[model samples]
Target chain A: MAICTGCSLLCEDIVASFENGSLKHAKNLCRKGHGHFQAAFTERTRPMIDGEQVTIDKAVERAAEILKSAKSPLLYGWSNCTEEAQSEGIALAEKLGATAEATIACTTSFCEGILMERVLSGKIETCTLDDVRNYADTSIFWGSDPSSSHPRHLSRFSYYPRGEKRQRSYEEERTCIAVDVRRSPTAQLCSNYYFRLPPGGDLPFMEAILAVLDGKIPKVADKKKMIELATVLKKTEWGAIFPGPGLIYSLQDKMELFEQLLARLNEITPFKVVPMVADCNARGFNELLFEKTGHASSVSFNGGSAAYGPEHSVLAAAKKCDAVLAIGSDPLSELPIGTARALAHQPIIAIDPRRSLTTDAAKVVIPSALIGLEAGGTAVRMDGVKIKFEPVMNSELLTDEQILARIMEAV
Target chain B: MVSAMEIYMLLPKTNCKKCGVATCMAFAVGLLGRQKKVDECTPLIEEKKYEAKLKKLREVMAPIEKASETGLIIHPEKCFGCGNCVVACPVNVAAEPTRTAVGLGPEGEKVILRVEDGVVVVNNLKECKRFGPSGTLCNACTATCPSKAIEFV
Candidate 1:
């Protein structure tokens, strides 16, 4: 069996067959996972230096030399890598991040960093995906569309299947509610239970729920539907809230309100929060970074002292740093265009198995083996479950850990 | 799924009992239930004036002709192998007692549907609820499919 690294769900029971560096046949894969499995055969990256083909050793040396000489270096993009690779990245960050102007950040700093701080600090309660499948009765998707993002979420964990306590399943026992800014595919499945919130209106929506729980009139346009939503919440045996980037960005510094809402719901019934994180091991990096440092992301180390703030974020670091090392992430296509322009101007060292915009424009590119299919390590699920995986096929390319460790030695 | 009313709209409304059914509506219903073939209606097939209606009706009911004995068609291209149908089907829930009900992939030969090669495939059509006289119009698999990949005709 193989685990798919396409998303944070980390679907474990994949039956795959590989021949001659390509996917021969696979079963139990979602559309995303199928594409991810097929990606290993397309657009394979090679070692390059300044757009010229080079040996792997030369590329590593150039990457190390560029970072060693930079006044401010930013080490970024560790979400798609394994926990072992991320640990090496952190060690490298500790070496260079201790420079007067160096910083370390990940893809989560853009959205999930602030919210992950709440989860890792015990401010919000989270559970394993297995527990959700076995016990959860009410699933509230707040600005999260698992159908388009995590395809197997509903069938494997959230709603569709019969659980230990929810043997009746979605027919009668399980109730799904979607709260989003627009009618997503998940919202359409919710039908009447979908509650549309305006952009940046998550706070008001939370207040309305609190009002209905307190038996007071809500300030929204529809009060009956609000009360009906409240009744669903009140009658929940065990509830889980799946927050996405929408809710995190909307709430921003006011994420304390979300914690208060969770606490209030727990007063009446049990509730858990699991942010719908993207990528394979984004939650893993956040948890590991949180374990080493109190803060999850956007931290800069100056003279061996770790400092945390927005000044150290990838967006801000893009302007501050003169060198970058992007592993397993494509910030050029993913970040704001302005940040991409800034990072594109700087000398970037990209380490990836696939060719992307970031790799296309990098000063140095060192290819690594694909994680789940070609190499194996542990990853954390979106719900904080640690799942260990093994490589399903053979590959001659080095893993991310070896590449990062070689660069650290060169530095 | 093509509806009875949809099939009824494409038939010849001449009310000519040449097909042995009392009314054209009953013939349309029989054609949908597979009790009467589309060629049984002589006016629609033989009469040149109603040739277009016969062609349109054939096009409409093409899915039913190719469907399994249970009148079910699962489009593999649209499926992501989430196993929603394997777990939602009542017959599968009773056959494969382990793994499928708690929301895991269904294994073994007792199951009616299994996800292979990243798509759901029919494993046992005989076990489907719509197979025999005891079969009812059970749509648990079609209704629960989020991708709308499973269809009943």
Candidate 2:
């Protein structure tokens, strides 16, 4: 079986057939994952410096040289790489006395890292998506639209599948509710269960739900709708809330209210909270950072000491650092225009398998092998499930682990 | 696609310089092209039929046409007394409020930060290192802005 690192699902059920060193067929791959797997054969980047192709060794050498000569270097983008590679990256950061951050800093600053860190440390109750598939009777998509992001979310895990306990399947056992600002694809699928709220209205909506749970009137223009939704929550046997970027971005400082609601819901019945991270290893990145230096996302190793705080985040550290080594992420396309331009002007080292806006302008580009397919290691699924895998194909390209290791060796 | 001449014939054609353009016809053309919004035409919506046409035209140009990969939408109604997006925008694409409008969502609702044009301007001007750049419409700055102003459309 092959693992698909296309998204945070980290689906371990992929089946691929290679013939004459080319892909023959692939099964159980979603359109997005299929694009990811197929990406191995197209738009592959070569080792380059100053927009000129160079040998892999030269690229690695140049990357090391840049980092070694830098005063404050920022090492970012490990969410798409393997755990082994991430370990090497941490070692490199420590050796170079640089700040080690991940794609989470950019995403979680507005999303769920703070909430997830607490949840992971046992501040709240949660479960794997597998548990949701088999056990959950109610699934609430708050500010998450998995229909567009994770196309196979419903059919493979949440709504459609008939798991060990859900013999009756989605026909009678499961209910999917969507709470979003707009009428999204998932909201349309949810039909009557959809709760459409205005922008930045998540806090008030949560309060209304809390009121309904408290057996009091909800403070909203549509109190009857709130009452009906509250009734659904009160009767849920097993429920799960999937918080996405929309909810996280809107309620930046109000995550405590969400935690309180979860606490309140637990009193009525069993409930769990699951965060929707963008990358496959967002959870893995958090867990690895936590286990290494007792930090979840941001950590600065300047002067050979690990100092961690929100200010050490990539968004916070990008401008402060003199040079940045972006691995497996395209910050130029993923950050705000100002932040993108700020980091772009620095001595940027982009390590990616394909061409991106960052690679186009990078001072050094060291192309690495794609994880989960060309390379093999472990990655944490979105729900904190640790999954291991082996490489499904062979190529001359070095894995991110090998490259980072080489850089560490050079340094 | 209403002609600029018909647009001029229908409304007061205030020829007000407030819309930036010299004539309401130019403003109408700008509005149709998303270069300008009907709300910019202070007098265009004063007449009942012109207002009805503006409302209908705004509906025809609902939110999806303006959606970028990041799924951010600008709320015109919610966006007032706040110029945070202008400062929060890294590429400075949204620096000019007059050119901004609701990207993808309801009519007369949700103002996009003009990141599309900003991306173009940044590239054209070759303004490097002003803010962090990403492959997608990154809301990192907006995410960190003290004002909770940026929203996904």
Candidate 3:
């Protein structure tokens, strides 16, 4: 059995068969994970510098040379790498006196980062996916679609699977609700409970839930529906709200409203919040960074200390950093045009298994082994549960942990 | 599975009732619902020219043949172990009760559909609501599946 580093679920029960240096068969792989497992065959990146193929030694030396020469280097994209790699990466950042941050920092500014801080600090209650499966009755997918992102989430934890408490009744025992701007696949599963909101409707919707909880009529036209929804929340024995980009993006700075809603729900019954983060090791990085620093997502290590601020984030650091060491992330394609353009012009050292836009434009490229498949390490699940994995296959390429350690030595 | 129009495109479209169906459209629905067999289409199967179409139709309809006593067929390749079917199955719910209302694995206990090794596998077929003469056509599992991985023929 092997773990799949496809998404934050990091599904641990994967059974794969290899034949003659190729994946022959794999069990328990979702469509996303199936594609991820097949990544061993495609776009295998090699050591490259200045768009020219070079030896691994030369590539590592070049990467070190670029980082060593820079006054301010930003190490970005750790969410796709393992926790072991992230540890070595943070060490390397401290050594170089560089600003290192997770790739998720791009979204952490306005996305899950704020809620993550609350969750990590225990200000707002949080429960594991296992806890969700065992106890949660009212699962509210607020601005998140586990169907498209984490395909196995509903089956593995949230809505599906006959849990200890949910076995007594039929479908209505576990109520799945979705409040999103559009009808996502998850919303379709929620069916009648799916309350379609406009782009910036989360605040008002949350207010409506609070209003209904207060036993007062809501301002919305569908007051009866709101009352019904509130009654479900009030009657919930244990409820879990899975917030996605939609909620965070919409809520933005007014995250207090969401917190207020959670508090309100808790006043009536137990309610927990789990941010629907997408990256495989996003929670690992978030947990690690919080352990080392007071902050959760992004931080900078300049002048020999870990300092976190808005400027320390990847999107913000791109404009300031003279050099970049992007490992397991593709900022060029994934980031905004302006930020991607900024990072594109700098000296970039990309450590990736497969060729990507970041590697293509990188000043130095050192391909590392794919996590869980070619290499193995630990990663925190979306709900902060730590999952350890062993390598299921062998590869000549070094792991990201080994690569970062080499870079640290070179620096 | 694809729509009837897609299945119809692969059919002979001759409106010929050689398969004991009225029109090719009805035959397409029959094939989708596993009421008609692809091999029963004499033009698609008997002719050398329709071999590719025959093969494609066979590939498409192959999963339906894997359906159990309840007409519930789960495509293992499409399943990511999202236990919609396992939890939605009334058999599992009716079997186990209390002990805090959740976190009960349907593997050896309540339900016929269990998610093992990242995909759903059927167990205890006899207890399934869709099993036996008293069984009704219950489809909570199939209906709740987001990927359409679960199908009842």
DockQ of every model listed?
Answer: 0.61, 0.01, 0.27
Interface RMSDs of the predictions, in order, are 1.6, 17.8, 4.5
Q: What is the Cα-based lDDT of residue A285 in candidate 2?
A: 76
For residues B1-153, write the lDDT of model 1, one tens digit per residue.
677778777777878899998988898788777787888888778789887778889998787777887878888888767677777888888876667777777656788987777778897799898899898889888877767788876
Which candidate order results from sorting by TM-score in descending order?
1, 3, 2
Per-residue alpha-carbon lDDT of model 3 for A234-321, expressed as tens digits?
A: 7899999999998878766787888888888888889998899888988888788788877887777766677776766777788887
lDDT of 1 at A219: 99
Q: What is candidate 3's CA lDDT for residue A392? A: 87
The clash count of every prediction, one per candidate, is 0, 35, 15
Candidate 1, residue B70: CA error in Å? Answer: 1.6
- By summed lDDT, the worst window of 10 consecutive residues in model 3 chain A runs over A98-107
- Superior candidate under TM-score, 2 versus 3: 3
lDDT of each: 0.86, 0.70, 0.80
Cα error, candidate 2, residue A44 (Å): 0.6
Per-model TM-score, in order, reads: 0.96, 0.71, 0.84
| Model 2: CA > 4 A from native | A19-22, A98-110, B1-153
